[model samples]
Target: MTRVPFTASCSTSIHKCCLVNTINIGTTSLAAFPNSLALPFVPHTKATSVRRISVVAMSDLSKSTVLVTGAGGRTGQIVYKKLKERSDQFNARGLVRTQESKEKINGDDSVYIGDIRNTETLASPIQGIDALIILTSGVPKMKPGFDPAKGGRPEFYFEDGANPEQVDWIGQKNQIDAAKAAGVKQIVVVGSMGGTNLDHPLNSLGNGNILVWKRKAEQYLADSGIPYTIIRAGGLQDKEGGIRELLVGKDDELLQTETRTIARADVAEVCLQALKFEEAKFKAFDLASKPEGTGEPTKDFKALFSQITTTF
Candidate 1:
């Protein structure tokens, strides 16, 4: 690194006054220096000689270590890839449940295989993490015996031991507890919209009560005393992101409008943006998007987060 030499000479009272006001080093101000670095300042009186000082600019601070649970999923994969792409900002790691999921990503050693439901299994993966993004949720699938051709509606069921209660509720609670133990700085959790209704149609899917359980986990995270951002996303679409205007609402209010669905990529972007802005902390809101090409895409994430005032 090149060291720049700064010179200060106070021959008159006017020169001393100018030195006391402020000193600008390139684009950095004197006040921006760390408290550990002691910079010389001119005394009240005028000096007789010029003082030359060698200034060595400091390097950038260390990057934060972030862990994404459920990195094997579609949205989680996006978040993990974004973090990795911004390597100067974060040290990204992925947590998956199976070897197949890990292989799917062609994951290096940074990817870990562990079950979130087993609290003991999460200890190692969660250690030393600066932030945690919870994306794990129970998935409902159609029962094999149900024939769509002969049925009014296909029957659904969660895999054995992977119901909403076990995955969304208990598993998320375990991750929260692990994060607390590890002293994580922040957490960003993604949940679905329509949680305000107790008898919503999603709850009837396999009787899993998915939204109810997800709401319970969100409430638990809110009460955990850690800074957090909770996003209750509307219907998830497989389309491209950043082509439609994103909207934020409270208590599923957006679900009543025509813009009730959002792309999975947009949701992934919001999860990352939440970590960049303090306004997103300790806030909860429903997220959706307008039809593609209707209006300008969302580029001001700080302003978007500022529009939300809900805590849960």
Candidate 2:
């Protein structure tokens, strides 16, 4: 997936004032037009005839508060820490569903306890947030009367109160709707790799339709008209891998590949990079590890993304 570049043009003439066009990646561009300063450039580069024009590319996230949902999750914690480390450029806010979870987020003034299922709970943390990162997952333990050990229709448990659809789909809808109402411009979602396929093994575990439900949520996000990036991650592991690299492509295209696991830290880094990339917006892609023999990291995410055309 490639993000479309937005550009603007300006002209200046000699010695009135310096006109600066600040190119902010992943968001709006700021063109400071001067009332008096103008410098006319000559074709020849001479000391007297030459004029200087400086174009500064500023990041859209600088000093902006980003609201991260599921801030107590593994990926959410990493994202929060990374954003906070760049505090000079960003103000990080974490949204948790419980006061306990909020406490787990370490008392950052930016952290707020609120459930995504309640749209009303979203308004406060979402207010003035420039971007949102969604990392919500289903409730951890199996509900009463559902036994993972027995293996007798574990899928039905998803429909019995601990419904994946309610949490994954409706919960996501609530977030999207609240974010939209809050006037948020950018969103990055962390989703599972097999989400586009109902037949995928992971779906079979919770119900043959959990992935389908996730896809439904994806569609809602896509139709929202909000600039978004969806990272469909493969089996998430907490262990460190020898080399860190991301193999990105359109959904459901790269199946039957082993060694697709990626470290959670690398995934967080990719999410951060996506916030700055104009090309990453409005795109949904799957992330997995490259083959062992495929050595060296590639700088071009677009080129890697172009290799696959199919989506779910």
Candidate 3:
């Protein structure tokens, strides 16, 4: 066997009869290929036996200016950090409600104070954003052990602002309207499951019917005609992510009676992926985690997104 150096300039596939054998790509290794697949370099008698691959140079280092709603919250904070880590691809800004919330963002200058419930306050926050990643949700004032029927768990709506009908539905609508007004190209919203069935237990809390209002907002988003992706996640648990495999589906296809849950970090990772990939655009899907395992978790987010259906 012999090795040949590939130059910065090369050309091929100029005609119908193109030969695809023993191809060499830069920074690529044998481990990149599947074990059972036929090597493109292998001798092939017919065209059907070989698949064509286009190698285009990726020179676009330009980044999108992204604004994250609920940036002070659990998943929103993670999403903000992940976007900032990939600064070459994304310029991240955190939109928080109060000065205290703004201080939580690592003392970053990108933190902008704004409340989503008020349309007037949202314009400056989304003035020049290219994409909006919304992780905001109304906080239910109840601990894990708290039960409403047992003389506990009150103030599900919290203060004057944090109600489900206002935040989950109207707050989202305000964001959508602001995004459209700003000429933003894409909107990625993080919501939860059980938005379909009226009997789902999540609705019983505060009689808020949070999922129902969430669905209404989702429909409003879809009909807005903007390039959008809605990721309806399961129970949001505060745990370490990147270790479990991500599972996704459309129209609540993955929903069941048993409560499914996922880590905030994992959801944060998916929110970034949804913002970046065209495959995730114009789609709404449910997201959950499989479990802890020794095998590697799925990293091909575009492929994972493509398998799901759209939210028409």
Candidate 4:
């Protein structure tokens, strides 16, 4: 599969089209095509084919300001830099919990220090924001009396410090409330794919119910009556490899796969895409990486999402 580069100078003119093509495997429709496929498929002229083109225009996203929470975390930091680097098309804001983190963002003028657990802290940054991306996740740290060198599980201590109850469930609620009050129209939340399963192994490290709490948070976002996209990512990893082309589907549908790890940078790209993808609004889906040579994902963001039905 070939990877498409996202450049700061990249731009496209939207057009509307209606086209039809039939293959022996199955019939498919192409609503938007840059040019006629007839020239390439002349040898297969016996196959059924239809041709049409429609055009629709989309406004430039460069003027919009996007607010991202948990800016100190891996995924949040990636999203901040990607959006900031494309400042010609997007205004990026990194919402952090500490002055040190604000400094890390290096006086971007878009950095806002705030905590998801406090509603008052969110008031300032959320104002006049066009979109919001929630990347906050409970991190594990070592606790007193725990020694990894001695074969002790320091993860338990870290999990204890990052309580999911206060940060995952309630903190998310606080964010939604603040968004509503501030008149924010769009939101994209990052969640885990196994969040509905309490029996998942990650929960064993923190508690039996960490995923359960995340499910509650997902439910809250669904009912918020705002334009939202909930991307439930598979096991996350931070590696140097490029993003693998992938298949996305309903929760837990892409299980038993070993290549599901997605880079934090790719997840951030999806979050940015969700901001302007009208078809992704009010939709929730799971994402997992596909194996090499799975073929390029022929579907664009809107086309892929239009196939799914959303509850909200």
Per-model TM-score versus the true fold: 0.81, 0.71, 0.75, 0.73
Which residues of candidate 4, in runs, are more than 4 Å off? 1-62, 142-155, 158-161, 240-243, 292-294, 297-299, 310-312
| Model 1: lowest-lDDT 10 consecutive positions | 13-22
How well is each residue in 67-97 modelled by candidate 3, as lDDT tens digits?
9999999889899899889887887898988
Per-candidate clashes, comma-separated: 0, 11, 2, 9
User: Please, what are the lDDT tens digits per residue for candidate 1 over residues 83-150?
Assistant: 88888788888999999999988788889999999999899889978899999999999987876678
- Model 2 over residues 1-312: C-alpha lDDT tens digits? 233332244443321232344323233344443434332222342322322345422343235678888889888888888888887777789988778877776856789988777888888999878789998867434456776688775433444544667778988899999889988978888888876566677676555366777778888998999998888888777855445556875654555676567778767777777777677788888887775457676456566545544433
Quote model 2's TM-score. 0.71
Report the error of model 2 at residue 100, Å: 1.8
Best by TM-score: 1
RMSD of each: 10.5, 11.3, 14.1, 16.8
Q: For candidate 3, which ten residues in a row score worst on lDDT?
A: 12-21
Q: Which ranking of candidates, highest TM-score first?
A: 1, 3, 4, 2
Q: Model 2, which residues run further than 4 Å from truth? A: 1-61, 140-162, 291-294, 298-312
**TM-score for model 4?**
0.73
Model 4 is weakest, by summed lDDT over 10 consecutive residues, at: 14-23
lDDT of model 2 at position 15: 15
